[model samples]
Target: MFAALAAVAIFTGFVDAIAGGGGLVMMPALLATGMPPHFAFGTNKLQSVFGTTISCANYTRGGLVDWKGNWPLAVLVFVASASGALVVQQVSTRILAYIIPVILLMMVAYLIFSPRMNDEDAHERLSRVGYTPVAGGIGFYDGFFGPGTGQFFTTSLVALRGNGLIRAVGNTKLLNATTNWAAVLVFALSGKMIWLLGLSMAAGAMLGGYLGSRFAMKHGARVVRPLMIVASLGLTGKLVWDWFVS
Candidate 1:
């Protein structure tokens, strides 16, 4: 069971590090262990922090990330995510269970309807004021609901800031990592994280992170778009099933 779960985690980490939906992999694997839903979610966050951290580092080393323009956004995301995670225990997952399907449907629609969006040579059109609110809001969302946060950040940076898809994805890694670490702290303090499972998954995630980042760098935005679309659709299916069947 452990070996099989680890294999799945590695694959998920790679896909997630590149495109931003590893939860699709990690969550189910953890739940398969018979952990409660809440604990599974929390533990996923813990493992994801390490995966994303490795992703961020890999992207940074590749010169795909723009840290100078993104540091402020990271700070805002950290604060907002921490606050949201702190409050997570008080909220009902049933609310998310209902809302996620709707959100996933919207994401699929956008991915399908939007004219192909690629920014090979995009110049910035957004100021800090314009982006700060968006960063903080999504950071809070990451902590509150926890799935699809990467897609949201990627789309926002691409549409609003005029970043190319690949750059946006790379930058999203850093910001998402920031939010994940913030949530991890809260989950850790609450003893909601399962270290054995999380670490086992993290090992796979780290390898996935490196491989995924490389794939993203090699292929660029055009290649990632279809993958993102597929992941989003799968996410929609998963959320809908969880909502209706659970």
Candidate 2:
């Protein structure tokens, strides 16, 4: 069981470092261990924080991240993500859940088929003020529903902010790492984490994150774009399944 968890973490960490939405992949392993859904969620957050941070660090080292200019947005993401976690308990997400897969499917199609897509920065459409809403929207979604946050951020950076795919992916890792911490702290305080296992999986994730970021840096969009499509499709499939059964 422990070996299976570690192997899955390595794979998901690789996928997550390149794309996002590894949670759907990780959850089944946690559930198979007889963990309650909420507990599995918390443990997932706990393990993911490490992998995300590693990926973010690699991106920063590669100079793909713009921390000086984007720190405020990071702070905004942290606040909004935590707020989303709090607000989720008070809301019904059935409609939102049903809608998100459609959005993801469209995003996957565009990213995969768009001839216009490239690793070149284009005309910046949004100023800092304009991007605030985007940051808050996805951050809130990250905490509220917990899937596709990285893809949402990367797409916004590319389509809305006109960032290059590689840079957008790097920045996505930074934002996601920031977003994960908010969930981690919130879930930690709830006292549900399985520390030994979480930490062990996290160790495996670090190995994957490091290797994945390196591959992305070397191959650029060639690697990231397809993996993102896979991740988005994976999330879309999960959401569609949940909507059907629920």
Candidate 3:
């Protein structure tokens, strides 16, 4: 079981390192191991944080990150996500259920129809005030339910900030990694995480992140779009099925 999950984690890291939906792979794999659902989610976050950190490093090394103006946004994202984690028990799953499908479907549609869109360079289109709310909201979403956080972050950077696809993805990695780390910390404090599983997944994710980032830099959005489409549809299917079954 550990070996199987570890393999999945590597692919999850690679995909996530490039485009931001690694959870679509890793979380379900963790859950399939027969752990409790909440434990699976928490442990997935624990492993994912490391993969994301590795991805962030890879992107930064590739000169894809803009840390100077982004720190404020990152800080806001971390704080808001932490707050959301604390308040998630208060939010109704019914609301999330109604909203998530729509959002996921929309993301899938965008990836399919707008193949030519996505910035090819790095430039900030949103002012600090303008982006604070966006980042905070997404961060909150990440904390509350994180399956699609990376896709949302990637889209936000592209649509709102006019970043090139590569840069947008790089920036998304940074933000998502930070949020995952915050969640890990909180979950650890609450004794909600499974360390052995997390470490195994982390190993896979790190290798995947390295390879995926390198592939993205070489291939660009032309490759990413199709994979994004597939990942989005897969996630939509999973969520819809889960929603129905649960």
Top-TM-score candidate index? 2
Error of 3 at 132 (Å): 1.2
lDDT of 2: 0.86
lDDT of 1 by residue, 1-246 (tens): 667767887888888877788887678878888998778878888778888999899889988788998898899999999888877778775777677768777776766676545647465567767889989989998887787898888877877787788888889999999999999888888888888878887787888888898888888867788788888878878888887687
lDDT of model number 3? 0.81
Over 4 Å off in model 1, which ranges? 123-125
- Can you give the TM-score per candidate against the true fold? 0.93, 0.94, 0.93
Estimate the Cα RMSD of every predicted model relative to the unseen true structure.
Answer: 1.6, 1.5, 1.8
Best by lDDT: 2
lDDT of all predictions? 0.83, 0.86, 0.81
Question: In what order do the candidates fall by lDDT, top score first?
Answer: 2, 1, 3
TM-score of candidate 1 on Cα atoms, chains taken together? 0.93
Evaluated against the true structure, the overall lDDT of model 1 is 0.83
Q: Positional deviation of 17 in candidate 3, in angstroms?
A: 1.1
Listed per model in order, the count of residue pairs whose N, CA or C atoms clash below 3 Å is 0, 0, 4
lDDT of 3 by residue, 1-246 (tens): 878888998988998877767887777777777887667878988888888888889889988988887888898889877877767645554577567878989987777776434546545578768988889999988887887888888877776787778888888888998898878877777777899878987899889988998998888888877777777778778778888788
Please give the RMSD of candidate 3 to the true structure.
1.8
